[model samples]
Target: MDITNFVVSARNQALLYGDYNTYHKQLAKKLHNCRKRLNIVTRNRGKFSKKEPISAEKLSENHEYLHLQLLTAERAWAHAMRFKAVHSADTKGITGRTRSHIISRLDKGARAAETLVNVLSDASTSGASDTDILEARAYASMLRGATQFEKQSWEPCLRSYATARIIYTALSTSMRGDIFKDLLSETIDPSIRYAAYQSKVPRTLAIPTIARKAFPSSDSALVEQINKLAPDLLKKSDSDAQKGQVGAPNAPQTITWRSREVKIEDAAIALALASTDTATALLEEKLASSDVTLPREMAAAYDEVLIASQDAADATKHAIDELKEEGVSQNDPRIQSLQITRTAVNYQMISWRIGRNRVLSGEHDGALLDSAPTTTRKSKKDATSRKPKIEPTGRKISRLKDKVVLYDSTLQSIDSIKELPGVAADEGLLEQLEATAKYFRALKSLSIARSHSLTDQSPNAYVLTKHAFDECQQSAALFSKHGASSSDSSPRNIEIRQADIQFLHNLLKGELQRTRAIVQIDSQRQKAAETVPPHGGSPLVQRLFEYPEGGANLNHLVDFPPKMDVIPVKPLFFDVAWNYIDYPGKEPVAATTPEPEQKTKQQAQSQKKGWFGFGR
Candidate 1:
């Protein structure tokens, strides 16, 4: 009763009586149950590793049972296919042919499942440990079920593969059998191995074995193998499991397989399988090998060459369109008219010369000889040259004479007064003379109106003269009284009527000259002052001297009166008298004193004469 030989014999017995169709169906159901159980175990003990003796042994045992059933199905399926193929060739009637064809088809379908199972079983027999056995069984079962599912439905395959994967996972951690470890190592996919290594499990009692009765013959063998292996298996399994659990205590289990495809068409999928550095290096190498130069200009030329050419008519049409947009016309009446008018105008002068030449050549009629002789008429005289001479009318002449008389009278009076003797020396005489001269000047001015012939006589002239005469008379009376009261020795008492009049005349003439000079001087001064700053001292101030009475004196001849009337006339008169008295080149007269005794005797005599004359 060696464990290995017993397993082999049980596997053979299962195959010998196995109805491929019936066994596959039953095995698929059992496998499905095992798959479910293993999946649950794998999930619960997710931290266990396929390398752990306990996990591997458990998983391998379940996979061994699964693979044994799968092998039996395979052997049965091969015999069925051989029989069906021969039967199909020998059959002749339609019914036999149909039955043979059906059997052949069924055999073909079954063989496909059997081939996958055989491949998986071989992997299981190799050093495939618990996880390996489980993964191989799952993969094979999935393929076989997939075929059946494709022919029939998906429920059978789905249930079988699911149960097989679960059962394998559970048995792997349970420390169930010795062969289980070997089976796992031989058949477990690398990805699932890694996943089992990272999984976790609770420290709890084992789950009740409800399906143990189903594997009655293998149970005793399984327990005995497990008893012998569990000591070493437990130690190794716990150690490996703990190591695998380091970073991922609850890591999910995954299935990994070698795909049938040796080369991948999609680079992305290939890159995914490659290491990071290798992938990066390959990408860079591809980039280096690629040609980056673009044929842009050549492409453009190719496109241009492919385009259809524009005909002459089309070009002309485009040009016409452009001209229309620019508001130009090929044939315009106004443009033609302008051209014709310009040409005619340009040649008109030349045409006229040609016509004149023809006429001179006498190529035309004798009309020139019949033309009348031209006459030259005298030019009329200008209207200004034919104007009448104007005579001086009497009224105008009389008015002229009157103007002359009035002017002469005013001048004569002013002259006569200025020439009087003693007027320059007399104090009051100059004032009186000025009055008279002023009156005469007024009279002369009035004469301008009388001389215009608008009036026969000027009342203003007579009134001015009479006023002067009255002022003269009053001045004369004052002079005579002062003269009679003063001694004959006093020069002021001397009456020089002629000198007084002469001084007045000079004064009046000087006044008129001074006024005119002022206007002219002001004009010149204004011009000169224009260039000077406004706030500077006036040029007029420099031109005149200031008098003691606060008035301005122009050359000692004209005196402008004080602006304020509040100033006393006595101070003004004293200033004028002082100026005159102190004048240069003038002699001062000496005063004579009277004798007291003689003055007393003269007074006594005057008194005696008055009394004696009354007595007589």
Candidate 2:
């Protein structure tokens, strides 16, 4: 049966909505239902029936009996957890009585689990599978570990927890779920670490190594079962633990950052750093052999190195946190050294992360646009050979957008490196990081420009392309001045190669010219379009405001041989000139007008009446 699943699901369902007390109540109700189903429950008002211990025969008869035993054990465990949580805030600490009470509850759970294990182990009578037996054993060991943990018996607690861890770790390999992993990470690992610490195990040893050492080797059956599940796990753990001890071959004893080497005091960091070195070598070998590797494949190859570096960084952070928790002052020599180590590991991690982005961004860090073949024939190949298919403009634009995103990520990673503890104080390193950021920014601009060009936005493309070119130049100069020394060549991070910079410089130079030409051609085309008359038949005189495109359409010039039409002149001028000069055929008649005396008198009277409508 899936014991872990059953227990975890019960805990989650109860604890998510309530707490352990609630879980205990729920388990009690479940136990009652199970007993009722088995027809062994006491009747109301009847004499109490003595509970009999669960046995293999009952489990064989009905699997519900196993369920009943599991619920009983889980109820007890929850009750203990609830009691412990309730008394956690006591100022004085847990009293001896309360501690004993808690341990009693845990012991009861352990006994019930042990009973289940015994029943399952009797395979001939219980009809239990090997896997079911092992699961029961692991669960029982977990409960026993909890009991010992509460009792402060560190060695026994470590041994019991290690057994559970080893079983769960083995089972997790064959199982396709995270239940075992969750138990290991969330429950068993922490308990084991604490118990090991209390048992005087050195903090330098990793939890897995500790668990392996404390695993009950005397239990032949357990060892055989775990071996069958994971054949090399025990041997591998031994080898891993040996890799970083003093005088071990290829052990990472120290790490160098900016020519300053610091000793690797923490075994976890040392192990992680050694793994990183191995991963870096492997990555280099893979990349070197696969000349035509895909971008994503190359990126995937970096994951191992990235993970190792991140582990080192995390280990460093954890060490620092542990020291701080112990009330070690910031000015302590150990604290100061750890801070430096933290910066170094974090920088290395970010460097590899940026390297992965660089790989994804494509050749020359995406400075050059990869043009698709548009021709079917080449001088070097057969004419009948199929040509590479050209991607659609939309697809090309999408690829450029992807490159832009990678460049943006690279820029962000470079920025993050600046925030590391001592990076900003290191002038040369800071310059290199800034230069790297500028380089990625240039690449991002180039990507954006290429996308714009694909979308027929010539002006925007030209502007962005020019900006990219300028940024690339500035970054190249800075890189040349502040680049890492030649002795530091490694595949762990991006190296600003002179050849790559030159190639990108040439490509961006040509791209700037190409984009400029495109812009000018587009502008000329627009100007020509604007100069074209709306009506083709309009004469030059009528279209004087418009520039003559296509040489003014000379065939429709000036209405050809000019057509006759009425023209307006000043008629009043002619009338005035006629009066000034004599005409040959016109008689000189009286120029004076004949006026009526009555009209003159009325005009004079009106002029007099204008003043007041009456004369005074």
Candidate 3:
């Protein structure tokens, strides 16, 4: 898998962790778009739009007016559905009303396409050229985009729109005046169009748009429904699975993802989970050690899980074939695997995911082990104006021990699947994997050093902290040595690198040097004490015999680490699942899955007409 996309996707998911309706609805929208794109592209029989290009167009000036109305209605209906999806994503919930209206609009839009097709079928004179057929196809494609948009199917919606743009651009070259104006009259928003066609996320993706805007937040309780529905990646999620698109007739793979992929992703996930667990544990330790209810670093602990879970979810989620732009049937099995690994991607953390949010919301002391007991509350409108007979209950709380247990259990489960067949890493991926391990080890080390500083008065705290600082330096060097920084210049990368540098300079030159200034027991008390300020100068080292509490800001020590674990990944995931057919690989259990077809670059170029894009 492209680590960057995988990380980005995972982060987006974890951010919406407590709010699943938005996430699932968004996923469903993408799936819906895939199905619509499949329907339009396969049925139309042409590269530009429908399956076939228009060979002719013969319509009187009178009939032209009716055609315009139908075409206009089709585009309008499609957009209406897309907007409905956006609303659902924003609200973090979907309504029956939204689905019903979308279905109604979709049907009308389909009818419009049929009508256009019928009208074009009758005329053999003026509108029969490739451009006319393409125009009709573009309408069909746009209509597909509309339905996909309604579902908020991310890529397919954009792909459909992009495909339409390419067709319209081609048509525009040959035709002009009212005919062209009519065709170009209703297009998707420019930003969306650009992002979709270029396969790039628009900078303003998170910003509200005129065509698709975010909805108001919904009740938190609804999240429970999603948790009940899907407990983990091990089970098929209800989001897109209910649509029957996965492993169904509309399953979208043109290539076979092999066993080797399953191995690499599983390892990456295992490490991410480990990191999350470690971070959460450290924060729990911090919470337990002090009278302070919250630590400044507590948020960072939550962040570690947020980052890790997103990576885990992305790695573990089932794959769809329609997302692939090209099939890699014939290629090196060792080198070319799906962007997602072919391993049966399964992991569970729904309860944990929900549990984390509860823990954060003060619903728990630390981790949640069970559901809340029933409770009663007083109503403002009560005649007595008193509390209800049943005792009222605030959100329940769990302990740090329980939270650690759950985190450990979660990691253990993933560890079970870490060694599926050919999941071994290549040289480059191995380096990335090692770097990930070393990175977490460094995190745990820092937590240890922090805890030591909190309690230890001996020079041990300084010694331990200095070691942790050294580990950070080594991890940064390891990342750079593995070429992560050069390959990815994202802000996250810069942050990690800079943090490491800052800590290294402070520890080696400042902290270590400060330790020498402190009064050592072996030295003359007068001389050593004179070298430094009096005791209790600063809390950071007061107990440690005079370290500065005014030392490095802890934020730099524990900001979210930039993950650069991408190995020139070819893609993920589950093709067989989408087709709803589970057949074991013909190869032996110990053997790897191999490729079947290899279309050379020459063959690809020659077959360009089969794809939807401008000639250039």
The C-alpha TM-scores of every prediction are 0.15, 0.72, 0.25
Candidate 1 lDDT by residue in tens digits, 394-456: 555454344445435434544544443323455564554454444334334433423332343
Judged by lDDT relative to the true structure, which candidate is superior, 1 or 2? 2
Clashes of each: 57, 0, 52
Error of 2 at 10 (Å): 4.2
Tens digits of per-residue lDDT, candidate 3, 158-240, equal 65565554444344444443443443443444424434434545321211121122111142322232233223311333322
The ten-residue window of minimal lDDT in model 1 covers: 201-210
Summarize candidate 2's per-residue lDDT along 61-110 as a digit string, tens digits.
99899999899899999999999999999977777889899999999999
- Which residue runs does candidate 3 get wrong by more than 4 Å? 1-423, 485-509, 519-616
lDDT of 2: 0.81
> Which regions of candidate 2 fall more than 4 Å away from where they truly are?
1-18, 37-65, 85-100, 115-134, 169-179, 218-237, 240-253, 263-275, 307-338, 372-400, 446-470, 484-492, 507-538, 541-616
Count of backbone collisions within predicted model 3: 52
- Would you give me the overall lDDT of model 1? 0.36
Instruction: Give candidates' CA RMSD values in order.
Output: 58.3, 12.1, 37.8
